[model samples]
Each structure stands twice: as C-alpha cells, then as structure tokens.
Target: MDEEQLKIMRHSCAHILAAAVTELYPGVKLGVGPVVDQGFYYDVLTPTPVTEEDLVKIEEKMHEIIAKATTFDREEIGLDQAIDFFRERHQDFKVELLKDLKEKGTTKISVEELADVGDRPDTASLYRTGEFVDLCRGPHVQHAGQIGVFKLTKLAGAYWRGRDGNPQMQRIYGVAFETEQQLEEYLVMLEEAKRRDHRKLGKEMGLYTFSELVGAGLPLWTPKGTLLRNILDDFVWQMRREYGYQKVTIPHITKKDLYETSGHWEKFKDDLFRITTREGHEFVMKPMNCPHHTQIFDCEKRSYRDLPQRYAETTMVYRDEQTGELSGLTRVRSITQDDAHVFCRETQVKEEAYKIWDIIERFYAAFGFELEVRLSTHDPANMKPYLGTVEQWDGYVAELKSWLEEKGLPYRMGLGEAAFYGPKLDFMAHDSLGREWQVATIQVDRNMPERFGLHCVNEHSEDERIVMIHAAIMGSIERFLAVLIEHTAGAFPAWLAPVQVRIATVSQDFVPFAEQLGTELVAAGLRAELDDSDEKVGKKIRAAAMAKVPWTIVIGSKEAEGGDFKINVFGQDEDLVVARDQLIATLLEATQRPS
Candidate 1:
C-alpha cells in the first residue's frame, strides 16, 4: 500500500483502540494518538492501571467495534464548541489542548506546518468513530472494518506531550498487518526477540548491571563484562595496526573554554555534563573526542605530506541522555567509542572517506554485521544553525553523495541530521532481533579545522586548512558489546569468547590434568579456565554452557592417558579430539582475520 493508505489504516486502528478503552473505562482522558513506524499508540489516563490481562478485554472491545463497521465521519467545529464537547465528557487534556490552540494563532512556516497552524480559529477538524470523537487532522480508513488484522502488542507509561514533568499517561501500543499470517509472523519474531533480549541474557551471563543508588543511565561493567570489553579492544587494536591508524589517548574532561571555542557549548550544551573541580576550574566531561584530537593535530607545525593524518582513540565520553531513554547497554550516559579522526587536505577527503568505509565494512564482516548507509546533509532553510559557509557545505555534501553514487553504493538521504560542525555518512545495522542501531559514522568536517587553526602548507608553500573526517568503525564499544551479546545470543565467536576453553575434570583424580591443560591453553594465548570446584561432571558442563564458553575439553582418564582432550564446540554441530599442539594451531588459524 502507499504511505497515505498505510497511515489511514494505522490511524483507524488507533481510533478503534481508543473506542475500546473508553468503553472499558468511561472516564479516561485522551492524549495524542499517532501512527508510528510499525504501529499506532493512543495515550490515555484511566482510573485503574492497564495490565496485560486488561488488554484482552480491550482487544475484544476493539473487535466488536470493527465488526460494527462504523464510518469515520469528519466534522468541522468552532474551537469553543470542540472545547465544550470534550469538557462535558471530562477530557481535560483535550480541553486544555483546544484552549491552547485557540490562544496561539497560526504562523506561516511551511506546507508541512500548515495542518498544525490552522488559519481559521473559527473551526477545527474532528474525527468521529461511533460515539467517540477526537480532534485530529486525519485521513483515516473508510470504515472501522478495514482494521482487519491487528494486535495490541504492549503498553508503557509515557508523559503527556513528551514533557517529563507533565502528567503520566498509559500508552497502548498495537501493530497492524494486511493479513492474519503477517500478524502471526510478527508475533513469532517478537517471541524470538524476547528470547534474545540483551538485558535478560546480559544478567543471566553476568555481563553488566545497574544500581538505583549509583544512578540511572550509568552501567557498571561486571568482571565478565570487562573481559568482553578487553576482547573487543584487542580485536580493534589489531585491526587498527593493520590499517595504519595511529593510536592516541586524551583526558575525559577539558576546560569549558575548549568547548566554547569549538561551538559545541552553544549547540549541544544541554547534552554535556558540566564538572567543577576543587581548583575552581569549570570543566565539562567530553561529549565527543573530536575537539581533543584537533588539539593533538595542532600541537606542532605540519608539512603538505603530513596531510591525511589519521589518529585513533578508544575514548570514553559522557552525554546527558534522559533516564527514560536509557536501556540495558544500548543507551547509556557513559560510552566508549572506537573513535578516529582523519585530518586530510581537501583533495584527499573523498579517498579518506572511502578508506574509512572499507575499514568499517571489514570490521562489521568480522562480527557478521551488514550495514545500511545514510548520507546526512544540511537543509538550506536550516543553514543558519550550521557552522560552515554555504559553499563549503554544498561542496562537501555533493562530493560525498557523488562518491557514494559513483561507487554504486545504495544510501538514503537524511536531511538536517548532520552534526553541528559537518555532514556525515551514518552507517546503521540491524541486530539479530531486527532492531536497527546507529553503529558507525563517517563525517566530513570543514569547520573544526578552522576553529582549531589546523593548517598544512600546500605545494606552493601557502598554508591551507585541513579537512577532518571523523569516523568510528564501531560507534561505542559498550553499546556494540550489548548488540553483540543479543546478536549471538551470548554465544560469542571463538576469538571473542571471554573464556574460550573450559577444562572440565571428571573427578578429583583428574583435577591436576585439567589445570595443566588450562595452563597450556593460556600459554597459547587463549582464555582458558579450569573447572575443579568439586562439582559433578554434568554440573560443570552446564555451568560452562551458561558462561557461553566457545569450547569445552573433558579431562578424564582416557584423555589424560592419551595426552589429548575430548572437545565439544558450543553452539556448533560437531566435536573434535585433538592433541594440545594441534588444537592450538587450529584455533589460531580459525581466529585470524581473512585477508
């Protein structure tokens, strides 16, 4: 179906949902009901809390409304009349909205804003379904019957009009499909997603934790979580060495003046956490690693050949992301991004971007992540907020888009989504449960160079500003680890597994043998552990399985006598019995990156 038709159907579903809620709870006040990406939601403040069991009654009511097949009649009424209608029904939220609408007259903005800005304070559009009516600018389905296959998926508490301090409303979320089979398929996917939820699995595997006292949005990494992070650090460092990226480190906080000069304070001050030290120096936790890297580039004079300087850092940064928005590890206040900046001459910008994209593709391939690339450009109408000159913005955006097109790369355009200082290419990936994430990004920045006075002499020995390309192969290591956990369902690949091999002793008699085998594996540079805690063999195996150890070696009388081990590969189809030397060689070969 077309976008308009799909929206009409989804909006119709929302109306049915609202009708159901009103019938079940007579005095509920309605908030905004809108169609989102996959479904629709209607916010309501009911007398009693809506639970999962309550949803069954709501669904039944919805089905009955749909069966009645009421035509969605549209009516145009005066602002006062609309307010009176909803006020008589005790929907204070609607009355308040109507009063605001009448008070704040329309302003001329754009075609998109026209609906929101009604020229006539005399009249507003109202959509009526059976006995229920809502103030809406809608083009809904012809009849309620068209909402054929839909399911009320979930519910959550949301603030009215997205204001946290406002009254909280219960939001009922539902998804619609054209056919019953499609609904069934979506339900199955949701079930599978629940099975692989990172928060649930992360806790089960002892990966990470959060404490209410320590505060929200700040995740405390457990010991096993740290091991997972170290594995990623090792892997990325190896890749950086191969790709010729110079490693660097910077402090987590810098003077407020640095952000002021960089213009980040003016543009993104709210997202940054300000810190004051004992010396009375006002500082802010770095929201990004770019400005610090710029300082590194400006530390000394540069030659033309020194252009295209690549500096990489696994840096920790802080953001004041709202507590409500934070999730397991996907969203957090503190993040460690595998960040790098390429300071290159204007002519080398495109090539440098292409090189960064290549590196990202390779890195994602190692972890089995496919990408969707988006070219984010500035909107001319919104140019006042962007830092660089119009000509520079035009040239950089055109060059990046042209290069992507020339290479036959598919990309969607995201208007007005650029960083405050630059245009960027956002690389997104879908986790195993089909939830999309912004994983990596490559940005072309023209403003930062001038801000920091970064310069290199050209062929004629005249100084020129260097263009900076900010790229992160894996955007944030912590967030990426969360995705990785869900993607693999905690079964990490052999190379990344925290404890790659677990040596299980059949009895106390074989405890020494298990320890010796673990020693040998550790010496071979593998993460190996010996299980000799007086637990039964079956119990030890189960515990190792829970840890998601990639391989397990059973050390019994037969294997010890032969100087070999019986190995079982977790999450794999087969087993192999190999001598110590042969096993190490095979593992090393398998773990090495493909050329």
Candidate 2:
C-alpha cells in the first residue's frame, strides 16, 4: 500500500491498541494517538507507568479487538458536547485541546445553529471503537480487522503535546504492514538499522560526541572526527578549485537588514537564531550561505567576462532547531555546507549545471555511490503558492531536464518539490541498506539577482541579469559523515580513514621501531598511529581492527630485523608483505584523491 493508506491502517491499529489499553486499565486517560514512522503511537497518562514487558499483553488485547472486527463510528459533535463527553471520561489532554480551540474562537455553535445569529464555529471531530472513544480527525479504516499485520515496537516518555511545560505521557510505538511477509522483512531491516545506527556506531567508534551542558544538536567533534571532516572538506575544496570556485569567507552572524534584503529574514525568521546588540541592533545567525555570497558578487562591478564568478565556503551555519528534531550528526543546529554559488549569464546556466552534475557523478562514484537525479519543479497549476513567476520557474525546470537528458542521464521529475526561489536537481544516493539520502543538490535561480540588483555588463555595455547556480556535491559535511559511517560501517577507505594505519608492536621491545615507522609514514603524508601499549600482540591487533583502521602494521622481531613491511588490510583475507619502498609507494597511491 501507499504511504498514506498505510498511515490510515496504522492509525486504525492505534485505536484498537487504545481500546485494548482502556479495556485492561479501566481508568486510563488518553492523550493523543498519531501515526508515526512505519507505525503509530498513543500518548497516554496512567497512574501506573507502562513498561516494555507490558507490550505483549497489550498486543494480545489488540488481537482480541481485531478478532471482533470492531467498526469505527466517526461523528461531528458540538464543541461543548465533545468537551463534556471527554471531561466525563477524565481525558484532561482532550480538555486542553478543547480549551486551545476555544481560545482560537471555536465554539459549539454550527452553521445551522448560527443561521439566525450569524455566528458559527467548527465542531469537534471524533471517533469511537467499541466503548473506547477519543478525540481525533481521522481517515481510519472502516473496521479494526482491516489492519493486516502489526507489532508493538517500543515505549518512551513524551510530553502531553510535545510541550516541556505540559504533563508527561507514555508513548507506545508500533509498526504496521499490509502483509506478514512485508512485516517480517521490515523487522529484519529494522534490526540491521540498529546495528548500523549512526548514533550508536559514532560513539563506539569515538568519532563525535554531544553534551547536555553544551546544549543539544551542537556536536563537539573529537580529534579523530575533526580529521575526517577536514579531509572531506579539503578534498571537496581541491575538486571545486578545478571547477573555478574561489575559496571565500564571510561572517557567521549578520545584521538583520542583510537577511531582510535577501528575503530570508521574512521566510525563516522564526527558524533563525536571533540576537540583539547592546546598541539595540537586531542580528541573526546565518541559516544559509547563499545570501552572503550574493553580497560578495555585488561588492564589485562585473562584465560578461566575469559572468561565472564562483565562490565556495565550508563554514558552519546556525539554526534554532527544535529539541525533538535533534538526532546524531544527521540533524543538528550547526550545519556546515560545502556551499558555492556561480553567477553566470543566462546562456551559461546550462553549462554550469552540467559541470556540477559531472562533479556529483565523480564524487559519489569515488565513494561507491551511484546517484540518481531528481528534478524538483514547482507545481504548474498553482502560481500563487510559488516563489517566482510561472515563466521563470518553467525555464529553470526545463533547463535542468534538458541538460540531464542531453547527457544521457536518467532522472525523475518531482512536482511541487522545488525550493521557494527556484527549481533544483537533487542527487539521491542509497546506502548499503537501501536507504536513499539526498546528498548533493543543484539549483538555478533568477530571483536572487533581482532581489540583490545583481547585474553584469553585456556586449552592448548594458546591464543584464545574471543567473545564479547553487551547487554542492556534499550538501552538509555533518550529515555526510553520518551517512558515511553507516555506509562503510565505520571501516572507511584508506584514503578517507581518520586513522589510515595503526602501528601495533609485538611488545614494548619494538616500540622504538614502531614509532620510527609511523614517523616515516607521517612524513610521507599518510596518517598513522603507533601503539606501544603493554597489551599482547593479538590484543593490539584486535584493538586496531575494532577501531576500523584501514591498515594494521604489526611489528615483530623478525619484521623489525628484516625491515620487511607486513600490513593487515581491513576486509581483506590475505596478508600483505612488500618492500619498504614499495609499501610507501602503495600508501601514497591509495591515499591520493581519485582522478
């Protein structure tokens, strides 16, 4: 089934679960039941807290309710009547919702009731299954039995309506599927995901960390993680330099007027982190780098010769993300974008886009990802809902579509997925577990130039509009790190690994030799670590492997005496022994960026 239909089915199962919950605990108060990822959950308040062990009993009761083929009765009742009904059942969460509605001018009066007085308000919508009734606006299944296969997954605590100031409620999570086979497959994938969970693996691998005192969503990169990020950033910088991107820098915070001029303040003011100076000047931490790049372009007068002035920066941009939205590196308050903007004449838009597309292909392919293109365009039928006029949007979309087709690249067109300012080509790369991630993006914009009055002198010495192309092969370094960890399962390739080679000695007797060899590797521009711990040889080797180091060099008496290089490569069965010079050459070859 489609996602929406599956949501409906899962939502219906939530009702059965609620019904079974109330059946077992007569006085349990319902908070809210909403459909979640792959399943549904009901926030409930109970005198006795629910634990994981209770899930089986709850599942059994849900099966009983499903067996009865319980029908759901949906009704639109007067606001007062609905409030009174839920009040009698001691559903305080429903009362809070009703009060919120009341404050928003909702009333028990309907159009028919207010025909004479000309005063009407929306009535409350609710659903009933057996003796269990809850407040909801539902598209639930007709009968409880229609929910095919389901499993209660886990339980966690949640606020009444996600407000910290509100009462705590127990959130029960579950998954629903159209078929038992699908359910089984999903469960297996879920287990695999747990094993590949970036948050879990990140900590175990010592890549990054988060501190509550430092606040949520702001990651403190450890030394190892910083190396990995710098490596990725440096590589991208070198790659873009070949594409004529000039490295640039801008301030982290800007006066409110800058964003106001760029239209970001109006659109994302609430999402931005705002600050006020001692002089009462309003400012905001930048949520994106494009607006600042526009200023750089406008700093000097340009001609057709400088039509395509590309600027790139790898810097942190801040956002005030909600606490609930914060995850590992995937979602964070501080985002580092390999952001670049290319200012070109209208005719060069196609060429610039092609260059970026080529970059994306080479970049992701080097990392073992075959990307698919998605052309996100504005909805044709609706012009009022979009950022730009129909003609401008259509041209922007058509250029990307034609460019991809001309290159013989397959792509999918996604309507109503375009950004507010322009249409874009998004590159999606799937991980090893078949989960798709949008890592790279390309956008063609005409609005930003207009907003900033950006123009270049044409052949006739007349001011002409410049098309801005925003391209980033690695959208966000933090997010890419999360994806990379899961994709390679922390065993990064030799070139990208934070610790390229870990030198483990057979004992302290060889510590001097191990350190000397590590120094040589470092001098040759390779990252290597020497382990002089008193641990056994086997333990040291295992330690190096567990850290996912690309190479483990074990130095024993024989190797130390003979000076023969023996290396254990991750994910390889055969041991590698080579001449000292040959090994250094191999290291240099493997660590160099792909051509």
Candidate 3:
C-alpha cells in the first residue's frame, strides 16, 4: 500500500480500538487516537484504570468488531455542528481539539453550511464503522474484516497530545500486521527486546543505576560498569597503537573562543553547557573532540612527510538533552567518546576515510553486529548557513562519493544532514530489537584545516594546507558499553566481561583454596572474585549468576583436595575440570581479539 493508504488504515484501526474500549467499558471519554509507525493507539479517560486484563477484553471486542466487517463511511460536517455534536456527547476533548486547530489556522467544515444555514463555520471528515464514528480523514480497507491480525502490546501514562501541562491520559499501544504469522513474529521480537532491555539487564547484573535525587538522564555506573569502561579504554588504546595515533589529553571545558573558531559556538551553542568565569569569559563544556585536537596541531610546525598526523583521545563531553527524550543508557547527559582526528594531504583524504570505516566495521563485527552505512550530505535548503564555499563543499562531497563508489560499499544518502564542517559517513548498528543507532562516524573536513592555517612544507618548498578526517569507532565508550549490555543480554563475551570468573566455596573448608585460585587468576590478568560468604552452594551460584560473571568456578572439598577447579560457563552446559595453567591459557586466548 502507498503511504497515504497505510496512514488511513492505521487511523481506521484507531477508531476500531476506541469503539471496542467504549463497548467493553461504558461511560468512557476518549482522547485523540492517532496512528503511529506500526499500529494505532487511543487515549481514554475511564472512571476506573484500565489494567492488563482490560486490554485483553478490549482486544477481544476489537476482534468481534472486525468479524462484523463494518464499512467505513466518511461524512463531512461544519465546525459549529461538529462542536455541538461532540459537546452533546460530552467529548469536551474533541471540541478543545477543534478550537486548538482553529488557533493554529487550520480550516474545516460545518454540516449546517451544507444546508445553507448562515455561513457554516467549517467542514471536517468523520469516519464511521459499525455504530462507532471518529473524527478522521480516512483511507481504510474496504471492510474491517480486511484487518488481518492485530495485538494490544503495551500501556503507559502519557500526557494529552504529549504536552506536559495537559491532563494525563492513559495510552494503550497496539500493533497490527498483514498476516497472523507476521503478528506472531512481531510479538516474539517484543519478547526478545524485553529480555535484552539494557535497564533490566544492567540492574540485574549490578552494572548501573539511576536516582531521582541525582536528576534524570544521568546514569551512575556501578563498580562493574566502571570496570567494563576501563577495559574498553584499554582495548581502544591498543587498537590505536597500530594506527599511528598519538594519545593526548585535554580538559573537559575550554573558553568560548575555541568553539567560536570551530563554529560549534554558532551552530551548537544551545546544546552546550555554558559557564562564566570570574573574569566574565564564557566557557562551554566541549561537545566534540575535534577543536582541541586542532589546537594541538597548531602547537607545532611540520614538513610534508609529517602530514596525516593522527591524534586519538578518550574524552568525556556533556550536552543538554530534551527531558522527554531521556532513555536508560541510550541517551545521556555525559559521554566519553572514542574520538580521533587525522590531518592529511588532500590526496589522502579518501584513504583516511576508508581506514576509519575499516576500523569501525572490524570492531562492530568482532561483537557480532551487522553494520548499516549511510552518507549524510548537505541539504541545500536547511544546510546553507553551515557549510562554506560551494566549490569547496563540492570537492569534499565528490571525493567522499567517489571513495564509497570505488570501495563498492552500499550506503544511503541523507540530505541536509551533513556536519557543519563537512560530509560524513555514519555507521549504524541495529540492536536485538531491530532499533538502529549511529555508533560510528567518519567525516572529511577541509574547512577546519584552512581555518587553523595548518600546512606542511611540500616538495616544492611551498606550504600547502592539509585536510582533516574526524572519526570515531565506538562513538562513546559509555554509550557503547550500555549498548553492549543490551546486545549481550548482560552475559558479555568472556573477553570483555568485568568479572570473568567467580570462585565460590561450598563451605569454609574450601575458602582458602578459593582465595588462592582467585589470586592466581588475578596474576593471569583476569578479574576474579572469591565468594566465601556463609551462603549455601546454591545461593552462591545464584549470586554469581545475578552478577553475570562469565564463569563460576566451584571449589569444594573434592576439588580442593584434587588441586583443581570445577568450572561452569554461563550460557553453556559444558563443565570442565581443568588445571589452573590450562584455564588461564584458555581465558587469554578468548580475550585476545583476532588481529
């Protein structure tokens, strides 16, 4: 179906849902019911709260209405008549909606006007199904019977029209499909998503927590989460070592002039956290790592051979995010980005861009993620203010396009989405729930190099300006870890698991052996925890499972006497009775990423 037809179908479905609710429960006042991406939802003000059980009954009512195969009829009515009709039915929300639409300069119709009654206010369409009618402009199926399969999925408290000041309305979310099989598949995906929810897994594994007193959108990483972050930092630094990246550190905030020269002061000033010093110099928290890396470039002089200078740093930045947009770990106030910049000759721009892409792909694939690539270009209408000279922009844009084409990489082009300084290739990864996120990005910037007056002495002894490539493989370490938590369902790969092994003893008799084993594991560069609490074996195992340690090595009288450990791997049924040296070697192999 076309987009318009799909929208109408969804809108009609919303009416059906509202009708079902009204039938199942009397005296229900309805708010607006709108069609979303996959299905439709209706907000209702019921005297009694609608529970999960009510949703089931309402869904059954919907199926009964669909079985009736009612035709959808669209009727036009004047604004005054429309208001009066809903006013008589006590649907004050609809009347208010009409008034708000009028305030927004929207035009509609009146039924009285059709009969030539004194200048009818305006006309609007109402879709009718069975005995149910809703204010809507509909393009529905021929009959309600054509709605093959649908399911009520979730319920939440939402404000009327998503405005905070409006009265709170209870929202019921539903999903429909062209086939019953499709609906079942979607339901299965929803279950998987719940299982992989990062908030749920993070809490269960003691990885992170949030507090109302600490404010929303700020996540406090627990000890395990902090350990994971540190390990991730070591991995990235190791990867950078082979790429000719020099590590550098910079403060979290800089004077406003730094951002002004970088143009972030003009473009992203609103999102920045601005502060004033005692001298009244306005400073802003750094949102991007590129400007500081540029300053480091300007600190020295170099020849043409010194071109393509790469600077990599793990930096934390802050942003002011919309309150409603806050999510568990996906959206946050602070981010530690795995950021880098490469200043290279113009001829090497494509090579550097591709190199970054390679690194991003490698890292994501190592964790079993399929990469989706997109090229975000300048949208002339909305992006005219951000970019530089037309010819200069064209040169960089053409080069990026040519590189992608030569590399034979499939990518979608997004218009008007380029960064202020240049065009970028954004790499996206879909989670277990099929939600896509931009996890890595590579951009070619000619403007910054020129702005900084950065040049290298060429073969002809002339100073030639350099081009810069800004790229990040993980985007942000903290966010990536959060994603990883959900992606792995908190059972991280043995290599990256914060506590790789937990040694437990069945009794105090084996406590000494457990401690000794843990120390050995620690010496082998593994994070090992010894559980000698006065808990039963079953309780200790449960605790280790809750912690999401990769392995649980049990040391009982038998194992201690035999001078060996009994290992049980998470998510694997295989158990091994192995020597200490062999166990450490195995772990080392697993932790060593393939080159």
| Per-candidate local distance difference test | 0.83, 0.85, 0.79
Ranking according to TM-score, highest score first: 2, 1, 3
Q: Write the per-residue lDDT of candidate 3 for residues 367-401, one digit (tens) a residue.
A: 88888878888766554545586666677678778
If both were scored by TM-score, which would come out higher, candidate 1 or candidate 2? 2
Q: Please provide TM-scores, in order, for all candidate models, with all chains considered together.
A: 0.90, 0.93, 0.83
lDDT of 1 by residue, 1-595 (tens): 6667877798889988998999999889998888986689999999988998898899999999999999899999988998899899999988877776786643221223343443557667899998989888788887998776989999998877655578998999999888889789889988887787889988988878899998877888898788888778767777767767899899999998998989988777878899889998899999999999999998988888887788999878999876556777888999988899989998888888888888788878887777888989888876766897778788878988898889898899999888879888999887666777788899988888889889998889899888898998788987888888888888888777777888888899988877877787789888788888888887887888888887888888988787766787787666777886688887666555443
Q: Best to worst by lDDT, what's the order?
A: 2, 1, 3
TM-score of 2: 0.93
- Model 2, 293-329: lDDT tens digits are 9999999999999879999999999988766557789
The runs of at least 3 residues in candidate 1 whose Cα sits more than 4 Å from the true structure, single-residue gaps closed, are: 75-87, 95-125, 159-168, 276-281, 388-391, 432-435, 593-595
Task: State the weakest 10-residue window (summed lDDT) of model 3.
Answer: 107-116
| Top TM-score hit | 2
RMSD of each: 3.6, 4.2, 6.1
Which pairs, if any, clash in model 2? Answer: none
